[model samples]
Target: MDTQDIARPRLSEEDWLAAAYEMLTESGVEAVKVMPLAKRLGVSRTSFYWHFTDREELLEAMVRRWEERNTGNLVARTEAYAENIAEAMFNLFDCWIDPDLFDARLDLAIRNWARNDSNLQAQLDQADTRREHAMTNMFLRFGYQKQDALIRARTMIYTQIGYISMQVHESKEYRISLMPGWIEVFTGSRPTQRDLDRFLARHG
Candidate 1:
């Protein structure tokens, strides 16, 4: 009707979800309410209703997005083609360094949120299992025996989880410096210079 009204950008579903994700990362799920998110976006609270039916629906959508982007994408990358297990290790390492592929902030926030909700906790557990299985299959594809693949996969996945849970802060250089040794420990074979170079070209 007015110039100001016309000038206000029409909000999309993604805009509300993005704001909610920021709040969830900053202050956990309980802080992801409609009014606060609306205020954060500088839009009317009614705008959210057009995108989400209620706060619970918004929360579910956030969880679904997390699953699709983080867990689903990670598994897909892990299963990507590699000449050997060492190259496969590098493929999976991309997930750790690439925020677009795996968001540590969102992952940690959801884990924290799960501590208080049984339903969410179950969902998190399922996701963890799926990830572990995917990693195990990667090793299996590289000719590991079933038992060995399962153990190695558990070791790799759990170590990453520990890094996230402990909130370890280290420069990327320092972290990448440890990858060679870590890959050896997880896969039972040292990374070749070519493997190291490939990883560094992307991450270093």
Candidate 2:
């Protein structure tokens, strides 16, 4: 029988990863124990072990995927945008910089876990650098010099991360929403009407 013709009832590797991701987001990394993971997937522990040798291995894969998900399609699309860069920046930051991006409880729990875990710290640093580099590249594409791009990229990311770090504590979004107007601080000053006119003339 053709594979498509038969009922395909088996769960996929993606399904397994999604379940693992949920466990990580809903609870903390500590909550993603081997038994709990198998239970979440409605699979035998044997089946789980067949796919992954242990929780540590699964966590390695999870962090790798998380890095890719963050700095891959999402950032790539943001940087490749042809439309309003400001709008793209806003939407992109909104996702990452939202405390609601994942469970607040989970976020706090993971933050604590990361402080003690070397692997987790390394993964976080890798993610941060990749994100910064991607944003820096985008700024460079917009005619910024390499030094200016690095400064601006670092400024943008730190500002967003700081906003979200507080967002989880405050359970509010208003402050970060007001960020764009603050962009002038990154620049020397607010753009003059003449400056805007000149910039548009060149880029138009």
Candidate 3:
């Protein structure tokens, strides 16, 4: 291994993963190329191969990291909420819908990559499951039965994707804020400041 390769081992796995996505957010999927990524880390090319087999493997690792992140956020946020539908649902949406919270570029890159790779499709499905499961639990708080919750969760997941899937030229902040009103139409209750505060006071 090169001396730089030895130094590369000092960086935590999370640090490396974050650097990869930070690059992705800056330049798109192509930014994560092995040689360039190694160079970006001030390490040798062999350093990357030591941690991952190849560029494709590293991309998959990145995908896995993002999937766990969204899944973990969903699980943690859902468990923290009180038995209030509107408040819980708003919290749930905030997890994925926030502009600064999630990197929309990450999903856009994966969706683009999926057009040429079947494997990426599976990773996309995993992320979808995470969101659906989390939102389903929120629906349960809103008085929906398991099956009904599952259906509603699926809808919520799609609606969320559609919202985020807007063109890069569109306003992300505006898109994130637009969903709550429609959510009220779908769920029959708009979350209010008082309701959210009560739920937070109980659950927070």
Tens digit of per-residue lDDT, candidate 3, span 54-166: 77777778777666665566666666655577767656655655544455666666676666678778767777787778777777866789998898778766665775567
Clashes of 1: 0
* Stronger candidate by TM-score (1 vs 2): 1
**Native-referenced Cα lDDT, model 3:** 0.67
Q: Any idea what lDDT model 2 has?
A: 0.60
- The digit string of per-residue lDDT tens for model 1 on 72-160 reads 98899888889888889889988887889998889999999999999999999999999999999999998999999999999988898
- Which 10 residues in a row give candidate 1 its minimum summed lDDT? 1-10
Report the C-alpha lDDT of model 2 over 87-116, residue by residue, as the tens digit.
445445444444343233333445556777
Candidate 1 vs candidate 2, lDDT winner:
1
Looking at candidate 2, the ten consecutive residues that score lowest on lDDT are: 99-108
Best candidate, lDDT-wise? 1
Off by over 4 Å in 1: 1-7
How does each model score on TM-score?
0.93, 0.64, 0.72
What C-alpha RMSD separates each model from the true structure? 1.9, 7.4, 4.3
> Per-residue lDDT for 175 in model 1?
80
lDDT of each: 0.89, 0.60, 0.67
